[model samples]
Target: MKLRFLPLVAVLLAGHATAQEAVFQTKSLTPEAALKAAQAALESCRKQGYQIAVAVTDRTGLLQVLLRDRFAGAHTVTVATDKAWTAASFKTSTLEFGKDTQAGKSMSGIRQVPRVVAAGGGLPIEAGGTLVGAIGISGGPGGEADEACAKAGIKAIADALEL
Candidate 1:
């Protein structure tokens, strides 16, 4: 009986060693920071004479702020949000992801994933080398323009995010 109990005790000890913590910590942008990013992106696009929409998401790919210019198309809302979500989820710029997922590539299948918009204008936000959030822009002339606006948005808040 003692020998049998040894196995049970060993098992319990092993389980304890491998147990995972019930809680953990994560970092993400505050609402004010997110809104600032969105506003900056919008202003950038406006300067370029492009009516647009901007979306900012926290590290978890959850929307934190969204801003649409007065004349931006209705579709821009969803596109901007999806782009931000894609960037946060993939932890990469949507422009690069779009190229990598092009047809004939192994990652091409990722295009089929809902909410994964493999396009430009989506960029991950990093602070202290850790991803803190993402920003996305839509309704510019094309992907490149949209991406430029997104970059401006990040630049606007870079100082605040630096650790």
Candidate 2:
């Protein structure tokens, strides 16, 4: 009787193992690509006469690159990194997130989350219809300028990320 049950259990376990995937694949930006994006953002801000700091993060919100202009403020580092992390983690542009979470809005409480920056400088990096990473820029005149620089950064790496 016990032998009969053991075979059943074995079959059940084997079926379960074949039914679920043991591992899944995910895409992320390479370190070199992240550096290129950061450099492009910094250059874009510089062209606009705005000293800034740029940060890039992988899909998992892990920092991949960070670049700061000589005249950028010290605080820009933390702000840039937070912006990148927020964009990647939230899977949305920080500017949109900010508007959605503004005071008196239903998502206002999200503003209180640690490392969650809802500024315009952060943008998600998507390729092949998948989010690959994020970029953030800080130390510009305002969120708009920072966002513009971040856009330039994405544009610079657009072709390579087409895959």
Candidate 3:
């Protein structure tokens, strides 16, 4: 009986080892691409007569690039960065996250998390059907305007990010 149990344990261990060996590949946003996205977002807002700040972050919520228009307020920079971080960390747009959190009593606690900006202007960046980063805009007159700038940033790089 002891010998039989020993063999079973060894077989299980071998299977576990094989499962642990399985690996997956993931992609992340590059600094160059992040810069382009930020630039486009700022440009888009400028075209609309809005001075704004834009930030881009990798999948891990690490900022890769930031841009501030000449007349943007100082606070806009931090808001943009936090918005990008929040979107990347949560895997969704800040606008959607904010609405959902507000509507659900249990999820409202998410707003207390550090660096979580529950607002518009944050959007996850996707490449090859996977989330690779996020872009955020701030300093616009309203959330809608800020979100439009963020969308323009993603649109600028959509072709390059295609699978």
lDDT of 1 by residue, 1-163 (tens): 7898998999998887777455567789999999988998999999989999999999989999999999999999999999999999999999999999999999899899989898899999999989999999999998889999999999999999988
Which is the leading candidate under TM-score?
Answer: 2
Candidate 3 to truth, TM? 0.85
Write model 2 residue lDDT over 1-163, tens digit each, in one string. 7887998999999988887777678999999999999999999999989999999999988999999899999999999999999999998889999999999999999999999998889999999989999998899988889999999999999999998
What is the Cα-based lDDT of residue 157 in candidate 2?
96
Task: Give the per-residue lDDT of model 3 (tens digit) for 33-52.
Answer: 89888889999999999999
Q: Name the runs in model 3 displaced over 4 angstroms.
A: 1-22
User: Where does candidate 2 stray beyond 4 Å?
Assistant: 1-20
| Clash totals in order | 0, 0, 0
- Best-to-worst TM-score order: 2, 1, 3
* Candidate 3 clash pair list: none
**TM-score: which is higher, 1 or 3?**
1
CA-lDDT, candidates in order: 0.93, 0.93, 0.91
Q: Model 1 Cα RMSD, Å?
A: 4.5
Clash pairs for candidate 2 = none
TM-scores, each model vs. reference: 0.86, 0.88, 0.85
